[model samples]
Target: MRRREFVALTLPSVLVMFGFMLVPLYRTVEWSFERVSYGQAGTFVGLQNYLAALTEPRFGRAVVFTVGLTLVVTVVTICLGYLIATLVNGLGRMRPLVLGILLVSYVIPHVVGAVSFSWLFDSNFGGVANFLLGRLTGGDVLWFTDLWPNRLIIALNVIWSMLPFVMLMILAGLQGVSRETLEAAQIDGAGTLGRHWHVIIPSIRGVLGFAVLISTMDVLRTFDNLIPLAPQAVGLGNESIMLYIYNVAFREGAEDLGLGSAISVLTILIILVLLYPSIRSILKEAKEA
Candidate 1:
């Protein structure tokens, strides 16, 4: 391609990155170095904001929750998504119907799904979750109160909202598995479990790895779905990193844009650091393939 044509084709994307991403990122980093309030920038404070953020008690707690949530969500999403994909793949004629039903949760807007999930476990208002528990265990479970239960609810909501996407990805991967391989395994006296474990899973390793990567990144920045579920966790423990950042930026009269920007920069760094190994592995495999 000619240089002019190449430039013309790439100009729009370049402009978009500058306008939407680069400019905002630049401004945020600048703000991180200065004290800012009420839409006004103050004296430059060097690395004080970063220092304070690192030393914050809430920062430590949020880091713990963020790490814990990412691990749990990634595992559950992969295991359950693969299981559902396998079940749906076996349905043949019923695959579309089952997939459509599973995808309803994914299609709902994030805010609406979060609200719906939050209401389902509302203990005080006798939500459906509590009502079911009442009937079965003779006691309503307060899902939003304790740290463990609240974390569990958050994990469940994350899984519910993300399961469809993971399942769909795995289902697509499953399509690439050869029927002859499964038949060969069966002829060798392999049971259903053995066939899947030895043949089907190996055939879809790359796709499964991609799905796990996506789920990990998504869970790392999770916030909206957790807000209504963990409102009482303002600035304290139990909040994810994103939620903690949100609280810092818009906590009523205590808003600290500089500190928030600092946290945001740190969050981006943390995500890149965490995902670096997976990203490198994927790129290396692609290159070799």
Candidate 2:
């Protein structure tokens, strides 16, 4: 393709994305600087809003929650993905069946998947946890009734939702591992664990790093599942950065667009900061590996 034609052909998508998405992202930065109310006009707040926002206890708790969730999700998803991909890679016939089941989740609507998973762990009737509690403890267990359990359920639900993506990515990475390298490890009498830890992992380290960064970013913005199944027996009151931002944007009379925009700008910054090292390391490795 000629350079001119290529630019002309791709110009529309560039326009659409910049107009619809990038414009709002910039506007958030603009709003973050001004003292804007939901429906009322206001003046420039300068850095005053930013200063106040950083000092808020809610912001601190939200940061703690977001960081904690991201850390847990990243570790769990990547580990599960590696293990599942290893099993699938070994199985000849089982690979396709197992992969198909997981791939179907990628296409499912987030809301539908969230609701379905919620029901599976529902406190009412015969959810899996209830059934297990009935069998093991002779009583029902209320997962959402306590803070730790409730947060754990939400985090686990995110893991369930995100695990398949990680698996698919790692499977692609695993496919890139040469048969020769694997054979070399086997020929050297390296056992399965040894081969995996030394040979297989280093070979696909770049993709694994990318997966961790992507999973962490996804966890940072996790709101879809938390929204429908929120403020239950435990309480979902502005628990995470994204959730807190949503509360500031739409909740009753306290809606502050400027504040919401500030939170969003900060959230984007946080994700970027967390992603930088892994992404940079991955790029460096790709250049060298």
Per-prediction RMSD in angstroms?
Answer: 2.2, 3.0
For each candidate, the alpha-carbon lDDT, in order, equals 0.87, 0.81
Best by lDDT: 1
Question: Where does candidate 1 have its weakest 10-residue lDDT segment?
Answer: 228-237
Q: Residue 173 CA error for candidate 2 (Å)?
A: 0.7
User: Using Cα atoms with residue i matched to residue i, what is each candidate's TM-score against the true structure?
Assistant: 0.92, 0.89
Tens-digit lDDT track for model 1 on 1-289? 8999999999999999999999999998988998988667577999999999999988888888988988998898899989988888879788778878999999997667988898888865558887887889996566777767778888889889999999999999999999998899999999989988999999999899889888888888898888778877752378888888888888787688889999999988977987898888889999999
Once fitted onto the true fold, the runs of candidate 2 whose alpha carbons sit more than 4 angstroms away are 1-3, 232-238, 275-289
Show the lowest summed lDDT stretch of 10 residues, model 2.
229-238
Q: Enumerate clash totals for all models, in the order shown.
A: 0, 0
Number of backbone clashes in candidate 1: 0
lDDT for residue 33 in candidate 1, whole number 0-100: 90
